[model samples]
Target: MNILFVLLPLGLVLLAIAVIAFFWAVGNGQYDDLDSPAWRILLDDESKPPKDPKDSP
Candidate 1:
């Protein structure tokens, strides 16, 4: 009974924060190019070989 009052407001506050964060992300282009990053992980950077410190000048 008493716990409900505390839990309900706490849950609502968390929900409000989540919604605000989602909208903020959308406005900041956070969701743009969602697929490219996933594909990028599978793609290899073959243009250059891994540099060795001993070989570096």
Candidate 2:
């Protein structure tokens, strides 16, 4: 029963720290720009070799 006092407050403090980090990420625009990356992945990138190449054995 005595351990609950210390452990409970420690757990609450850790939870509060996690909440602060989540809010910091939200305020810093970390969630912006979701779709372009998916479409960009489908687009043909010039740096990579062509898919239907004769050299492939």
Instruction: Give residue 23's lDDT in candidate 2 (0 to 100).
Output: 96
TM-score of 2: 0.65
Best by lDDT: 1
Model 1, 23: alpha-carbon shift in Å? 0.5
For model 1, the stretches where C-alpha displacement exceeds 4 angstroms are: 47-57
Per-candidate TM vs. native? 0.75, 0.65
* Alpha carbon deviation, residue 21, candidate 2 (Å): 0.4
lDDT of each: 0.92, 0.91
Model 2, residue 29: displacement in angstroms? Answer: 0.5
Q: Judging by TM-score against the true structure, name the best candidate.
A: 1
The runs of at least 3 residues in candidate 2 whose Cα sits more than 4 Å from the true structure, single-residue gaps closed, are 48-57
CA lDDT, candidate 2, residue 21: 99
Score residue 53 of candidate 2 by CA lDDT: 90
